[model samples]
Target: MRLTELPRTTSFRLALMFLALFGTCSLLLFAFVYWQTVGYMRRDQDEFLQRQLTFYSTLSPADRVQRLREHPRNDPGTRRPSGEFAANGQWLVGNLSVLPAELRQAHQPVDFVLPSAGAPVPFRGYATQLPDGHWLAVSQNVHEPREFEALLLRAMLSAGLLTLLFGLAGAVALGASSMRRIDAITLAIRRIVNGALTERLPVQGGSDDLNRLTREVNGMLDDLERLVHEVKGVCDGIAHDLRTPLTRVLGGLERAQRRASTVEEFRDAAARATEEIAALLKTFNALLRISELEAGARRAGFSDVALAQVLADVVDLYQPLAEEKNLTLQLSGTASPTDITLWGDASLLFDACANLIDNAIKFVPAGGHIEVRLDAEHRAISVTDNGPGIPASERKAVLNRFHRNEPSRSTPGNGLGLSLVAVIAHLHDMKIDITDAAPGCRVSLSWSAR
Candidate 1:
């Protein structure tokens, strides 16, 4: 599936999880708050009742009885704070206080807690009769019972809904922001594949994973782009240089065929053309070999090759040429070096080392010195030459295809020497460095001991 779709679908599942967790937490909090509030209200009402009873107990017993006798009748149902008295309450109060039939049968004073039925519709109350044939009652109207519970449920539902809404909004905002960055990367990749070799992903200067991945992939793309450009330039140069000689050979043969007074002259011209064609074909073959090595298509042929042996072979092959040019060629290292083995195609490695040595001998003046040194500690091999060293600014460029310095333009060699070495190094997961060697240049090839 598309890259954008992957993240989009994952976010949908994450949102559902976020909602469920937040909703559960909210429900628990609502339950806790409601229990504490309602419970405290009930406890406060009970405490008030205790305080009133204490107040009544402080009165003298004789005064309490006199007040009960003198006070007018106060019906339980119609009593108000204004002390309004009922006209015919004597019998109702006497019967209720003196063990009325309902109380005698139940054998207890009437006590109940329930909502009031009138306009107030209070939460709780209690009713009873005093000892002296007088009715007494206590009631509390702190809140409406059903109405309060209904309102609480509505508020909880509203809060839960609002929480879900805000949570989803935040998730969507974060998801969209991240998606924009991914889209930018995707578009950049598409442009690069479509031949925009110079394209690069925008870096926002963060140390996050996405930024690191972008940087690494962009580095790889940079190498690929340079390789492709180099290949293109080499192909163009080959076509230009070979086309001239090929045209001349064809023209000469055509002229010989028309002007031939005998078969020998025509055959001689045909032989010269064939030789030129063979040279051109050889150059093309070499170019193809380098390309194949760079492409890593020969990786399957890799084996554990002794680095010292490879160096010995290359030095042996080039010593004669170096001596003819009046140059010193030396290969000096431990007889049985440690960590001298490398994993790679033996033939390709030999060819690459030969190219480096050949380039070194060609550039160095007569009687100049060349050495192939091995560093066991560093698992590295170096080919050094006493010549006009390459400038630091041009070291990397020289490793690219068809790159030639102006000073070496007169040299009878193609500029694919170090470039091929670099390709081989990359294929073997090794590193190649062209650095200053005091009055000359040193090319190092290093590999992992593991």
Candidate 2:
């Protein structure tokens, strides 16, 4: 299968799975709680009746039976007893059917299962047998239970079921809403990859992860836009700069071949063509090098570097070149020696700094001044240069590969210097800015100081 056709990952699916698992666990927990609560409540009621039966056994058996029979009657002193009062606010009591021989032989409070009788409604009962062959029993009717407890259990189970249903629906709804936003952002990112650089993911501004992801994705698009525009400009420059010289060399060679008056002339034309091709090859090689650097494929080779030492060496190497161009180059600024180190590809940083110095020498006129300054700020090493300052409007524009100012349009250099600098800057999380100075331009390179 094509890479793009592979199943896409979704957070909503994972969220839904978790929600389902949570709901299952919650249902099991509710089931356990219901059974446990009902069991405990039943146990407490039965234990209370046992205690009352034991106390009632203290009375004469005849008196106990008389009380049970009269307890449910419509007497003037009719009152509800504590523990096991039925609906209509009365105790359930009556004589049971003939006891089995086993029950009769083992004389104690025994739970009996019997058929229903008139109002007594046979149930599991706890009883006590007196030594005198009389008996007293506390009957727990299965048909009629405590009204409030039964109602409460019913209500709780109903509420739990409703809550489970609503909770599942709410979870699904929330997952759907999040998934919609994510799908929208994914579509926008797909558009960007399809050459729509202006496409940006929407942000909800709630400081959520997706919002942060949107901003980060947009930032990536911006960087891609800059890189793409730079590549296009570089292609344009290769066509403009190389084509003219190559066309000239080709034409000269063709003319010399047509005449053939002297061998030296032919050789000169061929040599010039060879030189033009070599120059073209050099530009191509430089382009490939910059591309490789920008791709960060060689990051494994990076190492810790002394920022101050790198700056000092770069300034020294370019000083003579600056003198030849009739411009003064100087270095200023002091920072702690320990603070001047950075984690980076040292050779690349050196090349980047040298390129800045060369550009300064190339743009500044005779007697113009340039200074290379370095300092540690906010965990970064900064290098600033002074020369014919870049125009404010075109400061960003000049960073594009092959972009040159009107005045420097005729200057003899392909515009890859700053472009290479830009690649290194990005690799090291560095920032480079060209600003207009009082008299000339200033360039600054800032990288995270290790």
Count of residue pairs whose backbone atoms collide, per candidate: 0, 6
Clashing residue pairs for model 1? none
Candidate achieving the largest TM-score:
2
- TM, every model: 0.69, 0.75
Quick one: best lDDT, which candidate?
1
User: Candidate 2, which ten residues in sequence have the lowest lDDT sum?
Assistant: 77-86
lDDT of 1 by residue, 1-450 (tens): 354554465555577687789889998999898888767766766666445434444546466444444443543442211111122223332112322233223322232323246454332333334445343333344455446767887898899889989877766765675677778888988998898989998667878877898899889888788768877877765665567569989898898978978889988998989988886786677678777876779998878888788888899999899999999999977546745788888888888889889989888998899999888877788899889989999998888766776443567555667778888888988899999999999999888866
Candidate 2 ranges with C-alpha deviation above 4 Å? 1-20, 28-44, 60-125, 138-145, 182-195, 203-220, 255-275, 297-304, 307-309, 335-339, 376-386
CA-lDDT, candidates in order: 0.70, 0.68
RMSD of 1: 7.3
